[model samples]
Target: MMVDVLYLTAAVCFIFALGGLSRAESAQRGNLCGIFGMAIACVAAYLSVNSADFWFILIAIVMGGGIGVFIARAVSMTALPQMVAGFHSLVGLAAVLISFSACFAPELFRISTPSGIKVLSLLEMGLGSTIGSVTFIGSLIAFLKLQGIYKGHSIPLPLNAFFASSICCLLFYFTVTESEEAFLLLTMISLLFGATLIMPVGGADMPVVVSMLNSYSGWATSGIGFTIGNHLLIITGALVGSSGAILSYIMCRGMNRSLWSVIFAPEQAKANDAVASGGTRAFKSGAPEDAAFILKNANSVIVVPGYGMATSKAQYALKELGDMLKKDGISVKYAIHPVAGRMPGHMNVLLAEADVRYDDVFELEEINRDFSSCDVAYVVGANDVVNPAAKNDPSCSIYGMPILEAEKAKIILFLKRSMGTGYAGIDNELFYASNTMVLLGDAKKTTEDIIKAMRE
Candidate 1:
């Protein structure tokens, strides 16, 4: 009765935590709620288990928590996406491990009934193992790609989908037949299928892929939860799965691509084609002094940042410039695209780290229209989000994705490294716009130079 009450309390906390996560103001509270709920759930689970398992569980908890803390403290903001992928892989692996343990010690897991092993328990073990195996391998691939160990291009195998389908069918057949050997075969094949599934995805769509993999991990956890008869795991897994699925759908819609295309279609070739076919177009270049003068005279400015800004660690300098402009009585705001960086809320996280004001930042839908009326649209290390190609070129992979309307601004100032294309590998037509001026250099240094010039 006490364990049941604790579980119910944990569930309530988790529900509130999710609600708190919906807005930035409550995000910290949400995190606290989640942590508290997890603590209670852990205690409940530990108490419910046998004395023989206590020491093992305690050791595992200490090791895992210490490692988690170390990683959380050491990881940089730019590598957060890779870290998230790695963590998802860990969750997958845990599910797989749980399934394996259940298989090896069905008595310990209470899976065997008076009439041999329960069919439902066997089904849960099969599904849990398959999904967990797939998620583990798939998340590893995603981590490698995000970490630059694997090239972000599709590696296609002929009849890959057909082979994956055949594997699934075999796995189902073996599960129904209760063949242990076939179950092992199913696990191996699922791992291969997972690898193949993610190998075809390009880097540009990694955000969606990560979210999809997160959903897979959640479902795998839920399967394991059912196998273990753990209510807390079931509830938490459902929440995570639903949230990840929603995020994936939102990201897919933001890119103006279907979820099917994101998963199956190769995008690297399309991006390369867009770049190759786009002929060189001339554009005006300017120095930091020139940009300073333009910015000083402007009545309003909208700053747009991208993955490059994160890579260059320029958010601090960028915030300084915005603060300077604000002191001069100019209207300054940040225009954040839905898919601006490597992960969801990447730009926001960076800016927040730099102590940028919450009210000054606005999402794509909120600040997109204001760009046209603004005196200057200052782009820092962003390309595709401001690229007119997304709007004008139907053949481009990123076509039909809504942009920041930077081209609509009276004057556009772009701080970039070179004429190099973005992650999408498409030429930015906004660079060639008559009202745009390019400031080529490292984003942090350039912003600092502009600030110095403004003071001079």
Candidate 2:
């Protein structure tokens, strides 16, 4: 009976946490709530009398905990999305492996007569294993693509088709024959198929891919919950799965691309020629002295950051530059676009970590209004988020995605590692605009140079 209470409490906490995560102001609170709920749930589970082997449980906790801690400490912020995808894969793989084990360990399947718990357990295990195995492989490939270990170009259609057909055949064999070997084979094949399915997706769509993997992990967890008759796991997993799927779809729409197309389409050519040929209109390389002279005249400056900022670890330096400008009586604010990094709310988290003043950070809707009023817009290590393609080119993959209208600012300073396009694999029209000056170099080094110039 107390087990029921523990499960319910876990479910309630998860819901509250999710609600808090909806807004940036409340996100930290949400994260805390979720962690608290998980702790309570684990304690309750431990208290419940179980006929299962203690060794299995102990081993699982130790292994899982070790892996989790290693990932948290080692993974870089720029690689966070891929790390998340990898975590989801591991979760799904756990469910699959656990379920497969239960079927073999008949002693673990015992149930009290009136409860019919054994029947429920078997069902949960079987379904969880099947779905989890598939998700595990899919998420693994998604992780690789996001990390650039697998190139973001589409894989051959024949390979995809072959895997799809193999999975179907395996499923049919499993359905017709209830043999344990058949189940294992199907699980392995399904995992292979999942990996193949995600391999072709490009880096521009990594966020969506990560979201989709999150959904898969949730659904797999729900299956495990059903097997164990844990109502809390089932509800929480379903909620997470559904919300993540919707978010992934919404993100795809934001990019003006269909989910299917993102997963299947070939990578578009980079915007090198258009950007190289476009006649310069405004900002060109002036002397570092000349640029400082212009900055001296500007009354207000707004800094727009993107994924590149995170990769270069330039947020703090950007803050320093902002401070320098402010000392000269120039006003500064940091404008953050939603989806500005590889993960959701990435920029906000990075800036928060840098201890940037909360008041200085403005959302897309709030900051766009000020672009016209600002004298200069300094872009550091950001490309896609400020690209003009989102606003004007229907044919572009990111046409509908909201972007920082930095181009509207009177003067623009664009910093980058190179002339390459951003994740969307398209040229940034803002780079070609007359008002924009491309400062080509490593972000930290470039920003340091600018800071030195300002001081001189």
Which candidate gets the maximum lDDT versus the true structure? 1
For residues 1-456, write the lDDT of model 2, one tens digit per residue. 988998899899999898997777998898899999998898787777564666787798899889889989988766778888888888888888777766676455342235333544545565677679878888887777777677744568778778677656665555444457766776777677676677766665677777887888889989877766678889998998998898788667556567777676644534433543355344365445555666778999988888888889988888888788888889999898766777666787788777788898998888898999999998988888888877898777676788888988999988888777676667677876777777877787778777788787
Cα miss at 86, model 1 (Å)? 0.7
- What are the per-model C-alpha RMSD values against the true structure? 1.7, 3.8
- As a whole number from 0 to 100, the lDDT of residue 350 in candidate 2 is 81
Candidate with top TM-score is: 1
What TM-score would candidate 1 get against the native? 0.96
Which stretch of 10 consecutive residues in model 2 shows the poorest summed lDDT?
108-117
- lDDT (Cα atoms) of all candidates against the true structure: 0.86, 0.76
lDDT of 1 by residue, 1-456 (tens): 899899988998999899997788998898899899989998887777736677788898999999999999999998999999999999988888888888777887788778666788888888898889889999999999999898854656555676578677876776577677877777888888788889888777888988999899889989998988878778888988988898888888888888888877776446576545466778999999999999999999999998889889999999999999999999999999888887788899999999999999999999988987999999998888888888888887788998889998999999998887877777787888889999999999999999999999
Task: Please give the lDDT score for candidate 1.
Answer: 0.86
TM-score of each: 0.96, 0.86
